[model samples]
Target: MPLRRLLAPLGAGLLLLSAACGGGGEDGDRPEPRRPESSDPAEGAAELMADMSLEEKVGQLLVPVVQGTTAEENADLIEDHHPGGFIYFPDNLSDVEQITGLSNGLQDLATGSGAGVPLFLGVDQEQGMVSRLPVGTRFPDAMAVGATRDPEAAASLAGTTAEELTALGLNLDYAPVADVNVNPDNPVIGIRSFGSDPALVGEMMTAEARAFEEGGVVPVAKHFPGHGDTDVDSHTGLPTIDKPREEWERVDLPPFEQAVDADIDAIMTAHVFMPELDDSGEPSTLSENVITGILRGELGYDGVVSTDALNMEGVRQTHDDGEIAVRAVLAGADQLLMPPDVEAAHSAVTAAVEEGRISEERLEESVLRVLELKLERGLYDAEPADAAAASDVLGGEEHAAAARDVADASVTLLRNEGGVLPLEEGSAVRVIGSGSEEIGAALRDKGYALADSASAADTVVVGTDGARGDAEQKGLVADARASGTPVVVVAQGNPYDIAELPDLDGYLATYSSVDVSREAAARVLAGEVDPSGRLPVDIPGTDLEFGDGLSY
Candidate 1:
């Protein structure tokens, strides 16, 4: 047979197979089929996953940061890699309209690609220091929530947070920090944690998780196994958790167990290394003993496991970009979160599969689970949210009202002496400290006259830095002592800073710098709102130990 004749029948057979596969050619060549819109998104996802090649399957594991604000960047990521999800940062959110539009654009890109699964869009809205939606329903830190000792309040706040996040087309919240802040010097977990007690942390964790679930948002309990005891920040370097397994079982693992029991949708692994548990001295992101043995086998948590940001210095310093993704997958993580190099991650996983380091069955297990999550969240087949509706619901009047209520309820008043509080109306009051300006402005809004210097005032108000009282704080105390004015010191950081300035006439620890803390301070000073918030953690200076609260 001639060469042309021999090729003709082979080409015809190829066309028939393409037709059967629902792939048709562009300009007479076979193009991929569009993702089918189905009522049963899970079945649709399973069917689509079955058709994916090794490259596409591996691509599903890469959750890259989509750079730039345009749909073009998102479309490029989707068309090229077919990523399983998107993680939004503050930069990614300009407003409700912008975020909704961005999410719609990304979903359109995902659907246009051959993959049929809806992209899981996630954000870090844990409240206080790490909220992406700053303008949206700004609540007090987790510590403040814990101070209320009202799990119902925590759950209601979390539900309100979820309602706002979900209205903007975001389905996943990387929140409800479960770390028990045992070390007051802990650089990161400070006010972000519920409290130092594992049981209290567990109660708050369970409530927050339930609230998120009820609001139709997947809540992820994070920094797994705990990041509370370390002094170092993982963002700057790897923090080691050098404790015995028994200590971990008692102290660090309770909140996670509680969260898992509460049916939290996901668990995010911390990068801290616990040598006593893993022995390999590697961060949790790369250790099978930590992710597989402890989180899965020991704790018995069967939810989707995600890694902390792979771009962080802790994980990146130890493993190359490719190895980080591969190790996390092999370590039983269902998602490779925020890899510094997405292409390298894809290549690494593909090579690992070929080299038999990671089995196809393992890849399917993770990808299928991820797909199932997307389906369960109703991400697939749900229409893009209305722009007006998103604007109304996201950080709107209702959210602000809820935030104010939580702030009012969670504010703790730690002290009142000599009845110096309920600042005499029209009395000159000096507000001191970096946060004083903001706090003063809030007070002014309530018709209080606040002065800047102690010399001109009848009373001095100070913001204490929760850690140790530094030289600057000592200087402020000296000024307060010399002024002969009634001094009211409000420790905004942690109540622990109060030990440094015991000479003040009136001392109080609000335990947070958020609006709630400020409001609580103002109310206590004015004697309007009785300080019901007890000390969740002990004030360091007094003979009174941890968990002591005094009546005002």
Candidate 2:
């Protein structure tokens, strides 16, 4: 397997290109590291690749999650393994300065100040439900954006979020979930998707992708080929999408196609299996027909492709870490994300390339895509982000205002039976459920008196985290309704919470349980703002349609 001159068209104003090199020694150890003089990404990547070891080049194809909050905890791993990047989870981070210092420290160990290849420190800051950073502007979920029916709102927040992330030394974001999310009981992607409509989801994804790129963060439009219609969570078990090719195109693939049209730098593959697309029994993450045949050949996408976390049960159900790594590369993914065992995954890939099971061209193709995106984002020349500057940007007042706007706009008035809303800011109210005290305090701040009991209140405001199935929560709603007061339910989680409890006098769907969303629910109830958010998804057991919503 020999390194050859190769070039291919990819998005981001960058070409997937690498030049033949004579720099590495015959024994395959690297020479002294150096920076590229050329500003062009292709030339710069090639110049840097010229000094890489076969070990290093293989390492470039992997992005594993590190083990701790401080850089020293994972110091030996970074110094020894040479992973192209590392993913940040909540356990691996504590604050802005901590994460920033961790990234900067790790890079200093890996790259030695402009002497070696830099690291792609990344996170999954999708804002709602999946936000990894402990402190930041907690923007509402994609479904909240979907409720507003405006792609510009999605773009604006994404750009702002990108700036904040970059300020904290992160470069890649696995976000703006492109899944359609048509399943009402979808355990994984319920509020993550924009809406059920393919075109709208496509538009939102394209808008957010552009914003992330413009903000100097690589937004990887994800769960490719779509994971929207399933009822299972891939983190726990293997899920399968049984749609045929036509239905698959009609439902799941549109957003990804739109992502490609927007020239998204990367797309992540789903762990779920699609038999119609490929009946090989392999999940899409390990299927060549799905990745190479469908995504590359049929869709004409040339950017980087990454597998979802390989440590999950979805990808791990049938294979070990080593086999999963080898199969992912053969499946056309450029990055193997978070395999259970990084060393085994790395060693297996090396062995495969050495055994000629995976050709050098295939391996180099991934390496170039990884390098091309990193170089295109100016990561090669940029310094580690200023940790002290993070406080100024993360959870800024402006970002909070923007997030509030979306949250307020996404408050869907799912029901107003007997005109219970506009509950009069002075009404005596009793709020109960998860985050109930916050909702009660919000009303109290708005001049509404807090009632000690539902029986003494003018309106009983009940908050729920998908209480449609929770018996205790349902009993609370029932007791409130039994009190003969107008029981107004604020569904702070799933919109369908009101479907089973039809006796409730009013209902509001905020689409998220984040602080912004909780505050927005109060505003809508107090009539400080009108309910503008439409339904992104329908309440399956009731009459709520895809676009159903109301105002005061």
lDDT of 2 by residue, 1-552 (tens): 222112111210120010012111121222123568887888877777766667778888778897766655655565456788899999888887677767666655455312256778889988888899887788888988898998888997799889988888788899889999888788988788888889888998889989999999999898988999998899999898888789988988889989887779999999998899889888999999999998999888999998999989988888888999999999999999997898899899999999999998899888888887888998765655666678888857898888988888889997888888888759899888877878888888899999999879999888888787699999988888888989888887768787788777898888899988999999889989999889877678788888999887
Model 1 C-alpha lDDT per residue in residues 1-57, reported as the tens digit of each score: 334334533443443343333222122342223443554756766776776778778
What's the TM-score of each model vs. the native? 0.89, 0.92
Lowest summed lDDT window (length 10), candidate 1: 23-32
Query: What TM-score does candidate 2 get on C-alpha atoms?
Result: 0.92
- Residue 1: error of model 1 in Å? 28
**Model 2 weakest lDDT span, ten residues long:** 11-20
On TM-score, the candidate that comes out on top is 2
Task: Identify the runs in model 1 with alpha carbons over 4 angstroms from their true place.
Answer: 1-45, 466-470, 544-546
lDDT scores for all predictions?
0.75, 0.82
